[model samples]
Target chain A: MITTELFVKMTIDRWNGSIANVNKHLNALTDEQLQKEIAPGKNRGTYLLGHLIAVHDDMLKLLDMREKLYPELSEPFIQYADKVVEPTPTASDLRKMWEKQNGWLQEKFAKMKPEEWFEKHTAVSEEDFMKEPYRNKLNIIITRTSHLQYHSGQIVLLN
Target chain B: MITTELFVKMTIDRWNGSIANVNKHLNALTDEQLQKEIAPGKNRGTYLLGHLIAVHDDMLKLLDMREKLYPELSEPFIQYADKVVEPTPTASDLRKMWEKQNGWLQEKFAKMKPEEWFEKHTAVSEEDFMKEPYRNKLNIIITRTSHLQYHSGQIVLLN
Candidate 1:
């Protein structure tokens, strides 16, 4: 039987691979290149980094894990065009924030108990919330990874 | 430090949870309810089951473990209108099929070697190909649980 501990570890490792790849790609670019409209009306490089950091923040809340340190996310989410875009953060700042985010999330997953994998929970708001599925902690881990990879494709396309 | 063996175990466990939930849900429904349209358009419970089974068949190929017990599928992909809209599956067959797929996938993952995890491979075509950053073995493992759970939402919404 696959335990929650095993599942969390796999998730953390996969995220490690993904973040490493994205950060490597980001660090290769210059500031001007990061700002260039690779995909107009969508997002540039720096914006994508900020978005990733935002995603990790949400993952923490959803999974009931400890939140990571990110100083740039002070505003509420705004749907800009088809994307819920965040403003650009400096490349260096984004990298530091993401590293911190990933670190804290990893630590949380590492300590989680295997027995709680299937416990179901609902969010406080549903009236105005986008109704999807009722999920547990395990679901949260997998969903965030899927979401990241899907957006990573968008970033790759933007490049 | 996460080895391939550990990832494989995690992948298999996720499949177990998914299959259990889906099958449990499916077994509680009536055959009449199975045929009834859970939503607008032409979608019904049967369509959702068929789609999931079809995708499992596709996912089997994506994992590239071994040949399926059934013959190669020649039918078109199980798709839906509007993407998000769909009907639910019956509770019984959903569980049965869930167990069947999970068992098979786990066995395959266990037999695979650590070195083979990062191997490069090709698919029938670019459109059909499953590769890194999108569709790959690593992804198939990580996303399998979430993918099933996401569709389970579609199944629930159909109710």
Candidate 2:
């Protein structure tokens, strides 16, 4: 009984729900709170936010939707360790990046049709995609949703 | 593309991948490390493992696959907060429970056909399920995979 439309809707609902849950904790953070580590040695809340934004920005290309909005975020936030001796973005700067990237992602998702979700994205070849049909554009979104919520759970430790 | 078979395979792959990532970190943890909080004021690695065990136990019934292997885990691990007055399970006890539960779960998942995943399980009424086909049996697994990894991400902070 699971139609394509219903599948897409369910994915979107969970995606948004996970984001809302993370944002609730994120919005409550003070500048000082953001700088504190989620735990003693783990990455700081601010670093996680920037890392998430960088990853989501990469999703634009991975999902073959569009180019990244913030390619500049990759080095400090994604490539380097949080404890590395380098300058990092302020909590406010990362917050703006997160908001902007997700805002655009939301708009992009809204425009996608159910059928389009089944088509191959940038990652795999047309022939290869046919063999592993589930690795469609929609699957990327589903995987990323989990990735986002995984970090979100860590971020909630700041509460 | 994006047939039900591919969807089921993708879900199973991600579920297994998440478990492997968590287990890689888990296998390396000393007993003392399990007792340590992932971060100060956050749940200990022990609690997260037990909570994951309890939730996967619930998944048995939720997916209509089998009865729970450890019904007792529900109270101390799932229903109650970690700081409650109940006696907690040791790191070894929870580790055994996790292994046993997942071993059975992997076997159970291997037996499921693609069509079975699309059918509604025991939770929803037939009438309501018909209306909202998105609430299929497979959706539970999809959501839980994310739930497992979310906590797994938190637990990895101990490393």
Candidate 3:
């Protein structure tokens, strides 16, 4: 069987791969391109980018890794569900924030031991976690990795 | 650290989740809606569905788990890169084919032990696998899960 260490390493690799893909989609598009909707009246690239930033920021809180870097993004990008209003950052600004968020996650994740990833996240109660240990910190990364790729797919649609 | 068993189980759960998401997108759209381009000139939902079917069919071969059920799909969906020509399967037929494929996989995968997932896939040479044991069957599932999510994201654009 594969070691727990290898499992952790592979999960991180997939996370990084999704991040690279998301960046590629974001970088290839101009800010103007990003302003277009992914579909008719659906979430646009701008909202998707901001949404990802908010979700990743929440990831930090969920795992108890650190304080959120952009907690303000949660309201408009999430919670409200794409009835996006003004006073949000431009696509250009969101791109930079995406980079900043990923950079912070990479640093924090790099320092964490593989064993630490198996521990339950803040969302799960201690008693519940004892019963369902698979709901751990690394599982958050697994879900987020898929989640990022999902948005990345839509981001490419903005192209 | 989490056991290898738990890691395998979580990976499978994510795989199942992505499959369910893809099915949701497929079932929601009319066959006509799926024919529209994901973007102005990029892959359409139809091609994405076919491409995913082809890729998953190949996954069975890659893992040496079973023979491909739809070898014919490789040409239009895989080798040609979605410059689709005439005589492709209807969306109804493709949907049924997808159901058949997933049913077979569910049965096969259900029987597989966690340790079997750690064994090297067919693509890796034995020598290489010895040096890099992480190139295993489970890794393929992990990748294909993200891949399905990526397409599912784009498929939602058809709505």
Candidate 4:
């Protein structure tokens, strides 16, 4: 039988594993390398980094874990396409934000009980969530875990 | 409540969505673009595509849905690092393999009853599977869905 505790553990393991896979690539790059395009006519490493940070920041509210920590990030990183605007965050700054935000998320995840993960997050209403029971807090984690890995695959190309 | 049917549907939706996301970027690229490096010292678009095909091919056995269709893909795409080998399959051949393998997998997926996904696949024994129930066949689908999106994100950089 699939117990709630086992499901939570597996999900968290996958989440951390995906993040670690991305970090493996990110840690290998230098400041100069982060500015280069992932491919010709594609987003730069720095832009992707900032974009990831912004998305994770938004996840805080979306998952009902916390309020937005970096609301300013949405405009440049999430709103505009890569290289569409000037004055983006430096790689170092974005790295700092990534670490801080992920650290907080990790702590928050640890505090959550397995049963609580089935409850609706802030993004959904209690009624809608009841109707569509699959769209639970755990689903958010699964989707975002994939999202992180997706960007990580792109970031790895910078090496 | 989070029913098994709901979980299966959500997983399938994310699987298809990730494929769609990759296709959007892939459809925009020219044949020549597939040869370009995702970054200065990274895999080319062709390599990632072939790699994805090889992985999905492996998934047939991993999920116990079918037998291997392209065993040869493992040599160049999975075993060797990028650009380490010559005489790789052409872009056309790999693309065909990709489509065919995915089409077969989709059919297999469609035939599965929701509960079947919770059973142990060929890769795991009944004894161990019982001990770690979370390592069900469904978990493979979940992980590989993320795997597809991860590389799809990289392949998109070819645009």
Candidate 5:
């Protein structure tokens, strides 16, 4: 049988590995490339990167880790689509936010023990959690790993 | 603690969810759109779809489930990048193969018991798996789920 600790560790490994891949892809792109859309009339690399940061930032609230490192990111990246919110932070600033936010999250996530992951995230009500314990904090991490990879592929297409 | 059965079920749920999203995107795309590159000089939608099938087809061997559903896909989609091979299966044929193979694999995966998921897959040796038990059959599914989501994002960009 797989121990819960090992299972949680492997899941974390997948999350960290995907974050690394996105960083590699992002670093390889020029600022001008980040500005280009993946295709005609589609999202630019910068928009996708900003979107990833905003989603990951919300995980703080979703998992009850802390207040968002950059709540300002939510409006540009989440509530609006690529160009809908004219004048987002520069690609350079988004890169810094991505690094700082992910670094902070990595430290916080490492401190989370296996059993703690099985408990409900803050987004769920106590009553709802009692009925559906499967919607745990770790499930959010797993789903977000998939989300990060999805956007990583989109953003990397700019290269 | 969560039961082994529940954990495995949750993981499978994620795999199916991603598959459903991919299918949704594929169905919405016309064949003409599939021929276009995700970005200029990047992979076409048809190539990404075929690549996804080839990877998933290889999982039959990787998971020790069965023979690959389409050995032909390995050369064009896996061995070479898009357009390197003289011609690939029509987008229509690829869509059918994708449906047939994923349908078959889903059936096979649903039959696997939670304990079986922790066992080494065909690709791993007994000694290696003993030393690295985390490299289990279920781990392949998890990683492949991420891969599928990655390409799904790329393919969807054709829309």
Candidate 6:
């Protein structure tokens, strides 16, 4: 059985590692390259970048233990949904925002208590904490990082 | 362009919410309920949980920025490839591992740094850091969580 300390270390290592990579990828893009859409139906590089920024801002609510910023945004970003996937922040704007938000996250991490890693809170009204305390914090790391990667992949395929 | 901050936050929130829901769903299960295989031709709860844990453990290399563990495990779950779509960790073991790993993760968040979030490392010699910084981290979360949720949904169906 892996110890909780080992798991937590792994989770953060992976989560932060990816965050750094996204910046690296963005820095490599020329403005013109950023502006071009890879395919007819796909989001442009700028759009993807914007979308990611929007995603992080929205998600911060959960970290704050507040309600979701946009409860209306739902699954399947289908064109027909007419759903606002949060306001699309521009790339330049996104970069600044990305840096800022990650800054907050860093502070949050540094201040965390070891016991809090296992501290379980129900994000949904339907959740029962008594029966779910075993669920750990890495759960958040895995979910968030994976979600980013999935969309990033979509962006890559489009390019 | 979406800022990295907002993108990361949104991803984080969505995952937290989903996991909260998943915990609720899992807590609702009874022993008898867990035993019944939703897809008789494939893995049921016993196998699914184990599969998830095993896959997750493997993904830890990327999360922790270490070399891959269990390199001998193969590209997919080859041992059970004939009976299963992929090789998976056993369900009981996986759950135990998940609980332990997740517990550790809570502490990880506390130590996370905004600047560190953007720290980039190459996963493999040939892997392009410029293009795929987020690939390893994102892929780990997306694949494992989706795998769990898909099966958890199946587990729910059994009831």
Encode model 1's per-residue lDDT on A9-118: one tens digit a residue.
55666666666656666666776676654344444556666766776776666665554355346342213322354444566776787777767766766676765544
Q: A53-158 in candidate 6: lDDT tens per residue?
A: 5565555554444453333322313222212454544456656756776787767766776456555434533255454443445455566666565445334322
List, residue by residue over B97-129, the lDDT tens digit for candidate 2.
Answer: 889888898998999998898888788899998
Q: Candidate 4's residue-wise lDDT over B78-123, tens digit each?
A: 9999888898988777778878877887788899998888888778
State the lDDT of candidate 3 residue by residue for B61-149, as single tens digits.
98898899999999999888666566788888888899999999999999999899999999999999989988999999999999999
Each candidate's DockQ: 0.06, 0.67, 0.70, 0.62, 0.72, 0.05
* Model 3 spans with C-alpha error above 4 angstroms: none
Superposed by TM-score, candidate 3 places the C-alpha of residue B124 at a distance from the truth, in angstroms, of 0.8
Report clash pairs, candidate 5. none
What does the lDDT come to for candidate 2? 0.85
Model 4 has a clash total of 1
Per-candidate TM-score, first chain only? 0.70, 0.95, 0.96, 0.96, 0.96, 0.72
Choose 3 or 5, whichever is better by lDDT.
3
Per-residue CA lDDT of candidate 4, range A1-159, in tens?
A: 756676677678888888888888888999899999877788899998888888888878878877788888899899999887788888898888888988998899999998888888787888898788878888888888879888888887777
Clashes in model 1: which pairs?
B23-B95, B25-B91, B26-B90, B26-B91, B26-B92, B27-B91, B27-B92
Ranking of all predicted structures according to DockQ, beginning with the best and ending with the worst:
5, 3, 2, 4, 1, 6
Q: Is candidate 3 or candidate 4 better by DockQ?
A: 3
Residue-by-residue lDDT tens digits, candidate 5, A1-159 = 488886787788899999999889988998889988887888888899899999998998999888988899899899988898988999888888888998899888889888888888988898998888778898998899999989887887787
Residue B48 lDDT, candidate 6, scale 0-100: 46
Each model's Cα RMSD: 12.8, 1.6, 1.3, 2.2, 1.2, 13.9
CAPRI quality band, candidate 6: incorrect
Query: Clashes per prediction?
Result: 7, 1, 0, 1, 0, 33
Off by over 4 Å in 1: A71-88, A120-134, B1-159
* Candidate 4: CAPRI quality band: medium
- Considering every candidate listed, which one attains the maximal DockQ? 5
The residue-level lDDT of candidate 2 at B123 comes to 88
